[model samples]
Target chain A: MSTAYGVAAVVLVVLASALIGGFGIRLSRTTSDFYVASRTVSPLWNASAIGGEYLSAASFLGVAGLILVHGADMLWLPVGWTGGYLVLLVLVSAPLRRSGAYTLPDFAEARLESMLVRRTAGVLVVLIGWLYLMPQFQSAGLVLRAITGAPEGVGGLLVAAVVAVNVLSGGMRSITFVQAFQYWLKLTALAVPLVFLLLAWRADGTPGPGAGAATWALPLAGGREYGLYSTYSLILATFLGTMGLPHVLVRFYTNPDGRAARRTTLAVLALLGAFYLMPAVYGTLGRIYLPGLRGGDMVVLTLPARLVGGVAGDLLTALVTAGAFAAFLSTSSGLTVSVAGVIGQDILRGGVRSFQAAAVVAVVVPLGLASLTRPLPVADVVGLAFAVAASSFCPLLVLGIWWRRLTSAGATAGLLTGGGLACGAVLLTLVGGPHTGLAGALLAQPAAWSVPVAFVVMIVVSLLTPGRIPPGVARIMVRLHTPETLDLDRGDWRPRSS
Target chain B: MATRHDDASVYERIEADDRFRELRRRFRSWVFPMTAAFLAWYLLYVALSGWARDLMAVKVLGNVNVALVLGLLQFVSTFLIAWAYSRYAARRLDPLAGEIRAEAEHEAERERA
Candidate 1:
């Protein structure tokens, strides 16, 4: 509603982030601190940071908007997102931390002993990072346009600038503090407004989501074609996809040990479960209150002003606006750090200077992509990123950790096939536009098929090329599975050439 | 090449140890089954939401339907499984793994010194 409040919120968030990041930089002096915070972050702080980075523009703004439009079925997106972390907790988290890798590529090289596998993983990390980051930038533009009426490009530019400055100044250590702070800020931003909105609804006699819109309240009752298939595909993508996200996986490396990693993941589950509760509140309320509203993504921003009109409403709107900005910054910062880490270690010299340079490149590429590409619904693009991740990295991480017979050729083949197919499907959906019928539904949500194919190909190829298995497989397995508290001589798996 | 061969054999010896096998078995037994159980439970919820719309729409509480309840239960089960796993790891998985790790470390030190 008011540009002054919105602008002030944005400025304050930026200043706070920069301040926290600068403080973190002062505390961090070594290369290890810059890369993984010297592996000293505790469970609660790391969990909060994970929640902060994980709850992107898609979760903050898009989930509510989708629910506003699609109703009951849209709940699955958030459910699948939370459940994805459960999958991570059970399968990936502790072992990944125990792998002692700075980035996914490090894990790949260390596990498979193949430069090719490492390079392929490096490429996928950048690809997924860009795919995930584009939405945060685009949504930054959208929210800024909604709040202050700035040109779309300016908002993206502002976010890119802030994220770059933060990442360059402090690296992972500072980014962790910045993100952990944002998680609490975002929770309050949504939760406070929700209290008043619920009270307002109560004062107005608690109406349902309008009379006789039966399908709106019911999950698959919506007349969209191939609803069952799309739902299942979305479920598969998110449940498996989370472990593969570049930023998310990198957070595990910050945990002090495997035990802390598991504990941090449990905390993340609780934090996310609490935060996800508010979005549906905003979405369902939007239906009952602002029945005629279009651009569903704007519902969270617009609902406060519409339902609670006045200075208080403006203030609430500003709070949520600031939270939205935080979402963009935290997620973008985490993504940039992970992408930069991979690029620094793999492409340039492995040092803080290279990471700083890579951070700029990481943010710049996504900001450029954001400007060039037409914006999709923020959540859908994010889901596509997850699908790509599920197809590629999920198989790699799961098999690489547990399956000793996995060979370099197998991993290389699986990464290309799965990542390539998922990326192709995503590109078709984005550029070729929407299609009808079975092919369209399959293209729209590719994870249901892509994930299985990736796993099978990985297994078969590994079986065929059994001789290519790394000779140190037993040692690597012992390192990955054992408790870090153990006094065993796990090989020093530092970032290469650092 | 000789150093690499020795390292591999040492790790292979540890891997073949009965205690190491027990540790591996304990971990796989807990995680694999739990992973499968939770995934199956979650998929069942998704399936019901998709195909059993009429059933999901059945109101358990005022304006709260089977769909909403099932979705909330997914959250509950996630937290529950997380808590259960942490407990299980603490009691069963961690101690044995620690013992194995200590034994392996001792063996390696003896070999070196």
Candidate 2:
């Protein structure tokens, strides 16, 4: 638990990130490279980068912490998160890549032929980006506070500053390399410590995580009221939400083609499945070892030192600390790039300079929000962001890709209705103070009700306003559904130079 | 050469083509059923975890219960589905889509030339 190892780990990760980012900038010379790496990334590298960016603090630290506290029920969080990519792969991956859109708003405009829907989607992208980014910042602070006992704000600021610098320097291309490297680093950090911890437990005669506590080991039996409803809502939010995340969806744009996109997603599913297997191990081990540990988030960091007290334990702790920091940096960098891309394309004049400026805005606003608000448990807050996304963009993407009858008016109404309801529910839960019973559970987990309502509203509205279907719907559908191997005038939806 | 006006009509013609319809149908038929099946499987797992606590808690191994087994199975099923879909896409969806795309592009090129 020495401060020196933790500080060194933080410094090392930052230096490595900066170095990789610098390498990316040198490779990137054109505007396309700045946005989507000129769509040349191979599936393995793209999948690693996606895995790196996708496994945020929620996966690294929060999953273990929640599992440690909530028992088997919390396993759903990681399962739902990984299964989300299955849904993404089966439904959205190829067609979305084939859509030739740089951002979600571009997809909207291309599909609906309406700037209004595009602008609305642009706004939702920024909002969701902020919602997702706030937790990374907050958890960065929490993890730093646990490691070096630094002020909470300092860690968030350090992460924000580093992410902003990385994004502004290399954009997506550099961030890709940085994230891919971080994925391996994170896996080593957790997996290595785990081997030693398990050995130590075996040496100590292999005690279980309090086998006598019946409810603790049982799924949904921990006296959690409305457990059924909450679990279903969590499933809906995560399963459908992966396609809607601004950061996650934007990574697909880096694939060389629709086939590569699908291949990359398949790789992501495998990579993520492998990584997720370790966190639950840490959590279950924590139950027996760190019984008195109150701050559940600190379980991963504290376990190595508690179980193996020596220089080696200190080194292991430092390694996990480095991984935690990597989680914050890689996820924040991805979110910043996606958010800045939207802002640069929509709000500011289109150029790399605007993207740089937008990156600064993207990081600063979330840092400010993290400072102003009370930090919720990292995974819970992230779940709210997923709920909002599942309700909004999931519907839009699914309908936009498959259904030719989808009208602009339908999209706009659905985006507003679904995004608004989910966002309103999230805001109420965050700000309106805790209310127990049905209302609280419903507000806390809005995806079950919100997602279905969003889909129905979209379908009904599109049917009612049949005449509002864009005249170019057929052409757009052809562009989207067709493989990129086809030589057709898929209308250019690239970021326009302003 | 096909004019800009003709390009729109060409896309519409391609959209209405039997090959295009087959390509779309192939993708939808495979993906829709798979999506529904996996989603239903996942939800059933979630529902079982939520409502059937005693069932999930029944120990199948040393300190490993049905809940843990089912949870791990979700991971297995996800990987399985991903693998299956990629194979299906490569064999069934991608090849037919490629053929249709090639034909459409060839038709468009003949009109242009």
- Predicted structure 1: lDDT: 0.88
Tens-digit lDDT track for model 2 on A11-120? 99999999999998888777788888887889999999999999999999998888888777888899999999889888887777777787899999999999999999
For model 1, the stretches where C-alpha displacement exceeds 4 angstroms are: B1-10, B107-113
The positional error of residue A13 in candidate 1, measured at the CA in angstroms, is 0.6
Compute the lDDT for candidate 2. Answer: 0.88
For DockQ, the strongest prediction is 2
Instruction: Report lDDT (CA) for all predictions.
Output: 0.88, 0.88
Each model's Cα RMSD: 1.9, 1.7
lDDT of 1 at A173: 94
Q: Candidate 1 chain B TM?
A: 0.83
Model 1 pairs whose backbones collide: none
